[model samples]
Target: MEDGGQAQRAWASNPPTAFIFLITVFAFFLPILIYFPPFPPFRRDALLETHVQVGIQHPSESGLRKSTQKHNAGRSVPVTAEGTARNNAKDGVEETPKTSTDGGRIRSLWIYPIKSCRGIELRQSRVLPTGLEFDRLYMFAQLRSPFPAPSSPSADGSGPVEHTWHFITQRQFPLLATVQVDLFVPKGEADSDKAASGAFLLVRFPWKERGLRGVLESAAAKLSRGWRAQPEKEFVLPVAFPVGSSSSRSPSPVPPGSGQESDAEEGEDVEIEDRRPRGYTHEKVTIWRDTVSALNMEAELPRELRLYLGVSNRLGLFRVDPARLREVRRCAPTPAEAGYQPVAGFQDAYPLHLLNLKSVRDFDAKIDKDKDLQELDPRRFRANIIVDNNDYSSPYDEETWKKIRFTSEPGNRKESNGSNDKKLVPSTFHVSCRTVRCKMPNVDQDSGYRHPVQPDKALRKFREVDEGAKRMGCLGMQVTPLFTNPGLPEGRKSWVEVGMSVEVLERGHHVYILQ
Candidate 1:
């Protein structure tokens, strides 16, 4: 009995025995512990109970109270000039002696001469009432099926048949991005005729593999010399479309001198008038809801160009007629006060789309982390003005800017009153609406290849916003340039350039939060 008691005591006190016992127990339960942890699973109920107990003990103190106290503590502290300067330094908000130190500069300028085609970058460009000069001046279009009959009836009482045209864009043809434009502004002696005769537009398909580059290059070379050099291949198709013509055909010319008898019979002098052949074809065309007579360039387009596009498409060139200025629709800060209604060349809505460089960077960062996509390109957005803000801490800050002012010279710092301030007047553009993105951005601007999942998917995840009936992913702000210099000649246009100082005239009342 003594020996048994001694053995039991020795077993209890032995470290090696206890260690082996623990190891055996752990080995036995290892798989079970992994399958079902020994500790209770985390529960919201337990957490809430603990929180309630903590709160009861500290009833007088809460997160809200703590925040309020922190806010009030800052206000209560008396700040000296030196202390304020130190605080400002700590906060990183600079105090500018001038009106504003947040002077954003235009980093790049782009003009899309042909709708949905490749954009042209420029250091300086003239700003037309419609948009930047030559922006969206032309669009590719095709004849709509089941064409509408002409408004007028034929002499035999039969309805006049007419071919109707509608606008086509990158949404249908991604290859449009391959088309490039070269605009030549005549210099020296021809400078005064800039608007009339000196300016010429040459379009070319730069795709070398398709053998279109040579054809386009030849056409461009001929157009540069003179339109008359290639009379049969006139680069500039002269269009004499009637304002509201119902039929595609040109009106019958009045029988020669039918209005008045020969003045020679009335003992009056008869003057002979020189007649020139009408060099343009007029057609009834519709863009969106606005139907206007336009000149179709079916005959003017080169055969190789049409073949390269791989479709029976005609290019429609329409100039913004001063007589019929289209008012900006569905936008705030209406353009009615601008004396003349704001116009656009062929833009779907607002003339200018502005994008911030920081926004693009932010979007690219998200894509890199979340998606298996190639790095995004800013060219996909095709904004007219890209504002660079190196000091801006947040992306999409431009969404809060309701109005922006552009100045030629950066030194005079004056706060803009939005209108009628001569000191602040330069050129102002009002943010009309958030630009709703489409699948067009999915098509690579350089390669014309479509990504399986990209921009659209990522934007849906991060940048989706409620716009009308649909939720759209947006990246840029659509804007309209206010007519600051209304006193200038009717035909004279304004200008904006790269490297110009851009100031936020006013901030939006509401910040657009992304979903």
Candidate 2:
């Protein structure tokens, strides 16, 4: 009798639920492998996104089950408008408050793709039940440019020499935050397939407001036609300073050899300390310093590599122009001396703002403290995926490759609603995902960045079964299987044969839940 009792207790302690949970997290490492967990398809140019809030109710037939989080390089991942929203969908998600699909009060919504760069400023956007549309759509792939050394050379090629690294991630420089860049829509030719036309250009540089004010002065410029065409939408990019200034320039230098200096060395002073939250030290200038300087002592962007907006994940904020912003050239970099200058030379590729998520405590604290307010630029918190999300939304926030789950049968609503009504049907909405902490460094950085290892060896063992598979959880993915995948052999190579972590890729309509 005693032996039987002990066996039962052991099994109970190691609940079957625990094993499944481990699998869920392990698979979470594979982002591209995951999909939007069954929510409605969300897109931009619509306001479905303003509907996600706790204390709000979603109609069961609101009709919006979609999938998102496209896989990149290898793994699938989920996008975070704010790091991880407390599943406020209907009934509590896991252990979150029940939020309603409201749409009245103006709550700031943000999105950042690739961590940093300039976020797309949206007054009202539709939530593709999956994520922001066209977010992180363009990444700045390193294109060669022709610019000479702005600074003198250094012996070790490490001094404050002319900018060395040509390519920058939105993760490295958050100052690109001040610029306002919109895709060029040629009179009659603009669509997803055709948007990639040969004449892609940014007619105006809205990095600093003065830059916009100067637009009329240079109206005869080659790119002005497109700038005048953009709808006057007041989409503000995030400026990280609590009280500071701004600009709108792009990047231009690339480190040629092992011993090269960054072109941005003039005043690009980045001193991140391990002791405090991350911060920056670039000049507090506007994109139109040259013009302002003519009348008074003002500043202008020294270099053009404003392609990126490097932000620290720990800081919960990105830099923005406190004094309002103007615009600048989305022009291509000139090539001759050495590398490409990111003067909006995105004809082929562009840079993405990559936000770091390694700093856990500082960020989580920010989110916790601001749980009730909806004013300001995302409150420097409330970021669903705060990988250095500046005041604006990221272009990489949208995707269609990740596989996600939409839990429909939420059992009770009153538990989270505090209402006596027990007949609330939890709509089939939401997704379950885990952010994958890879064992690799961020692709952009040359050193320092490293992914965290799993805490448990057993989970590693199971994850090994899916080895060689892409690790996602960039947002972890979860699914209540309509049918569990068949078992796999306990081996590292099991990943090659185990094809169950991803399932169900479909599109659905999206509705908003704003209270």
Candidate 3:
């Protein structure tokens, strides 16, 4: 009995040798298992989740469509046929059973010069085959980690990551919304020498730790809550766009009878010095699955701005390399449904994003039950074109639209003898696919803070309509300009302007392609 008691004490004091060895081994490999999981990690669709890596690898076809229904309590209506809509009337929501054909007008136009940053609203914007001019022409990338640690932590602090010039978006950093961008072109003809030399981009953002006076003013402004504070810092960057063409420096034929000094100087070329920084470093950066070769701006950014973004590493601003164009092919089930293969710059997927205003209002109505949540802001969606859909009875009627045409009706202005004015050329856009949304819209565009449960939670209730991305909810539709000769010098005639009539040219079912 004494020997047994002694054995029990010895066992308690020194566990089993095998057990001790196993624990020691576990402690040594714990980090490795976490960093590199032995089993497949819980990964959402490539574009559906925030990717830690610079570029997300394309998963297998079978894996792409896997159901990732996070909130499955709400009734889901499968979009099997054209004009398939949910009957929310039973749920105390009034819904129209029929679709409207008269169409809606373009309410607003927006251009995001920098990807995922504050966008500029335009009254009229020239439309290129790729997208609206000056839309997503540049992007801010993280060059290094702020932490002294070898690898910087992921944006969500998922794990240690090494991101060298990886694309940064609101999904990763909501504060990016605070960065404001403006294009400044000299007040003259687009081809004029002065216009080219003086064009620049104005960028502004808030900085940390203002001086004593600035701090006191900020505190006073906060306490008052009656006025808004301006950005703490601002910087100007040279604009170089239209791919290879130098800004306004290239010689263009002067307009006829411009009141210049002499007619002989009309064709004379002016030598405007190139103001862009020299020795631009080229590197490959990834936006979704495509890896694009981009030019790293040589201009040094303020350290305060980098620190404001929660990074110690220098923030690298990149422009799309002119030599390498990223072709945007349609992500559809069949070739017939796949539209023209246009090119893009720093945009996430397609060239243009169109949203129906009624749809947004309906989304707001859906979340009205939650008293804690406020009305969802349309800016959170970041759509390039917002159309007024008061004419349509049903929200999300765009889900059935396959193509849209834009036309401007001539007013009563007529030629001599009362002949009707020539009809304006109509521009058509192919509806590529339904926009698959992530939690990106959850970020407040104004405050730059993500809402805990939001339109994202409400979206899952009724917006999950795409069969391809069955798990993700869809809100807007991706569109591509249908131009016969997009590459010709004079082919760019389509202009999307506010108040233009938007008519549904075709209607059909849509299936999402995760390319």
Candidate 4:
């Protein structure tokens, strides 16, 4: 009987041990259970429907969708006479009624013709589908790799890889900021004439030596002189060519064994007078992950620029190909569904970048606590639109503005209750996403001198935010302009000028807090 009792006690203890063992097993697989839960299949459509119900429209179906469809369908929505008059208003004056005091006025406008270069402040500017007229139209690109022949297959089995080009920004080349760019579009010239003349993009480095400037000025003068001599044809000055290739009209060459070749001889000074119909020569180029076509301005560029920019591998002035519009990626609908994609010239992301003055002042306060630092220049952000936010209490309030509608002048207002009416449609922009800032802001806009500890450090401390897989600092909002004047004929003047009132049409649900 004692043995039986002992066996029963041992069995009872064994049950406890078994229970402990099971607990250990459960603990081991807990992570798996939590991570790979046996939940119902996720239905994107249902989630989207839920989002719609909550007043969160799909990014693709924002204000731009309907207008784009209408534009694609060849329907001309007439612009009100008032709207036209407001658009034609003189710079620095508000055409809107003084009674309309609820909205913010456009404080300033800026356009950067070259990516990563200094921006030009304007009192008034034209807005295009891509962005502000001439904004990021040109970008300096370096040859990433040589064009592989068809016989030479890439290791990745992607077939022959042609020459790859990538944009060089201040992040990589801070010196680019030192290069001043001035795009001269002759006033009163017709669009066709302007295209034919090809806006003279004058780039100069005033800080550099006089010799470099002289060389550049001389080359530009020569090109301009040639163009003026024969306005119909396109002139290209060849800076460099493949070795051993002979030009039909070559400059004086060095004698054999001279061991020294003149600049002309080394580069093969060849002038191409292309009589063929004047049109941009388009070539495929890569910017970030997007491979799109760009207009190659290499042939038209002066030799001096090649030398200044270091064209050992290859240097080219590339313009965003208007024919091959680069659709805004991330938080926007696909080009096919959108009917017409919101295009950008050579912007890192969206068409327009907006920054509130209050946010900048707040940032300045944080960095320049002692007021020692030269008042932090808002130009560092390189925003296309700068809005005065003195009325708002908090900084970065613009981030929460999901959609903004720019009111036309008092004269342009039509008595209409429908918001969708063509006559009443204000210049609207859908805030696409918060701009992900990089180290480019560390460089001084005026001098291109990079500071070791600055905006970057301060940003990392205050403005850092996790963007999915990566952490980036946020400063401005990327915006896509919704078509307000669909009836305005193509190439006709339509723009948002300074002093236009901006009203918040929609607000974002979540308040983005920088960690």
Candidate 5:
């Protein structure tokens, strides 16, 4: 019996019982082993919960803060240029200065390309540097980038980026039909009595190249009776920004005598056609880090608005600084205050002189502000500084102008109050002054020139030439055009057909400068 018990114990101690038991159990439940869990599956629930937790912790890129933009309805909303505006103009703003570039505070004269449209004014706008900032920031470029002449030709001989964009005119992109441009500069809250310190308008225009179809060249040709076929079709389009959003063209104001140059032989009513813009035909209209929303909707613009002032064929306006002139306003009596009556019998004798701040580059610096004019806002014209100018100040009687030194000026941005409260000159001074005659073409009742369709017609070469002369600003005349037929077969109708001359009344700055 003891031997039997010892054998049993040894068998139990050395047994492979666990393996044998598991095999026996698995064999009995083979069908159950083949199957998965029978209860409702909650795998997806666990996964979704994890995803939500992660998502909540890290969100997508939040947008940035942009200055709140005010929208005007329908179209050409009249913007008062003086010290009064519907949105921001007030009665207490300063007046347009007439004497110097300093002291007497003056605002700029903002010019909108579209009539009655409002614009933003700026303290100073630099040219070459700042011109495109105000004007070209909103155009749509038909050609992607400046074209590289034909590079050898394509496999099918199609040509390189001959004309990149598949453009459509405002006809296709109706939203981009009319765009009003304005420069927005932010000032500290302290300067504006805690107001937004909003910007002053400089200029505005109808954005032309929206749909990547209508090009400035094509439009220019259509507007001009002058060209066609070859080079006209090859008309180079300007650089424009990307398309923005879908918005109706601003309600248009009757275009002033100055009108747009567009030519579409499709012969649709140009006035009605002016209402269309483009879609996905552009990118955002912007300059540098500063972006101005354009009325466009092109989605796939490969490039952003990169070109500023170098747009194809658009015209631009520029400004002048008040500091450039000799202090003449202190001596020249105000036309309203001085009983200054223009002589009647002298028809073209004392025609008004227009001082162009933009043309400063063309003339030699008689004074310090020549280079500075390039920085002034062409649209924001503040007539603070005056000239003995045969002159830049308001139309003068010549007799009222006297010589004087601009006094203890801040020596910075000039003003009309004689360099501060110091007066126009340190002491009484003298200067030799005189007046000259200039005239512009008389528009007749039927001069259809006023029509938006025929705006380029009323323009005269003589007027343009004289405008250039205004910048040269000599004692007499530098390049004024008469526009009379010089007895030529072609009536002096074309700007190229006119001739010009300068009649120097007084000569030489040979006189020594007296400080």
Candidate 6:
């Protein structure tokens, strides 16, 4: 007791020693304070609100069942539009609210010219039976090597084998997102000129090289220092669309090693025109289960573009062949049911993919707080049509929509005169099935960087609700145009634009049939 009293008295007498002890304590914990603060500096929750209030509803509550009448409980009844309205009224059931009255409309339209590459956003686009015109019309393929490939060194065991020319995507090469494509259509007098007769596609990407200088340049560009930054390399090709043919010209011989070897190792920015002859060759390419013949545009590409894309053996640009039509086999009704099997270009499954914005926000709210992930971007989903659900719809409401119709505003709607008047009515589509998602959505469209595990991982927590494929998560609705005729005349063409109102024409449980 006497020794403790003496120590306390000495410590109080020496102010310098007390001050030094306090400084030492702060110094020991300073790093911890700096690294792990009491509160997060940034918060993404301010503008967004959680939408997990409602749990996954039962099938009955989902309103997807056709009807509760004992006679029609389990079977679907084919009825005309007038009959449907009358039946619903007699049953005391309200129709799905119209978008024009409720403020629900198409938020945007995206057309991906080349599969897995950057997409183009448009205010309006021509809607065909096979979806938006030019959507997924082109894709990249890995040319097969003469010798057999060795065992893959990849840890995940995901390297593709067995196929000679398989399609490539962000799953294999995330850097594809860095590539940009622009479309320019000729109009009026410009169409008369032979050189400007066809549309033009401009592709651009960052310059790729090796060595210390290249590494330094890349680092600088990433840092946005603008020190020794190289301009984005670009190339343009003529886009010729035949009236009823696959390509404007027939296949031509593409000689091997046609262009001079690129001097990309030394970081030389070569001009796009000095590289190659303009020609295309027919090639068979495989995309997920179906193999289709596509036009190879390799002769028009520069060797440097291949290296930048990280293709070691060989690469080819493939365009959809109209003659070799690849019909939608998955989730498709039999020919007897629809009179025809819908055809698509290079879409993975369905002709049209529709995403609801409210669902995306709900997904964002479901992400783990501990992971500190950024707000999910709608671009990640890559839907052809982005619909603003507004207040009329809730998250996952699209799953109950069996059929939807898109109506243009009064000014945009066409006036029909005679027999074709029915064709001029609002475009209607049959909702086929739920979109089975893949990790390709984890890749950032703007940065070309992929998250280790993300929105996909978060989705797996609760979105595996599809009866057909409960093992996979679903995000959007896959739809096909409902048309009585496969080949429609020019006057019967339908167009969907941004701000168009969407209405649910029918509601029923979807039987997802995986291809």
Relative to the true structure, candidate 2 reaches a TM of: 0.25
| Cα-lDDT of candidate 3 | 0.62
lDDT of each: 0.56, 0.25, 0.62, 0.57, 0.24, 0.64
Candidate 6 residue 63 C-alpha distance from true site, Å = 30
Cα RMSD (Å) per model? 27.7, 28.7, 21.6, 28.2, 28.7, 16.3
In candidate 6, what residue range of length 10 has the lowest lDDT sum? 46-55
Off by over 4 Å in 6: 1-103, 144-163, 188-197, 208-230, 241-279, 333-340, 369-372, 411-425, 484-492
Give per-model TM-scores: 0.60, 0.25, 0.66, 0.59, 0.23, 0.65
Model 5, position 61: C-alpha lDDT score: 17
lDDT score, residue 120, model 4?
66
Sort by TM-score, top down from the best = 3, 6, 1, 4, 2, 5
Q: Which candidate is the best by lDDT?
A: 6
Candidate 1 regions exceeding 4 Å error are 1-103, 147-163, 189-196, 206-279, 313-322, 368-373, 410-425, 466-469, 487-493, 509-515
Candidate 5 ranges beyond 4 A from true positions: 1-119, 123-128, 131-135, 144-162, 165-177, 182-455, 464-515
Better of 1 and 4 by TM-score: 1
Question: Considering summed lDDT, which 10 consecutive residues are worst modelled in model 2?
Answer: 491-500
Q: Considering TM-score, which of the candidate structures 1 and 3 is the better prediction for this target?
A: 3
- Which residue pairs show collisions in model 4? none
TM-score (C-alpha) between model 3 and the true structure: 0.66
| Clash count, candidate 3 | 1
| Model 4 TM-score, all chains together | 0.59
Superior by TM-score: candidate 1 or candidate 2? 1
Q: Can you give the lDDT of residue 207 in candidate 6? A: 81
lDDT of 5 at 284: 30
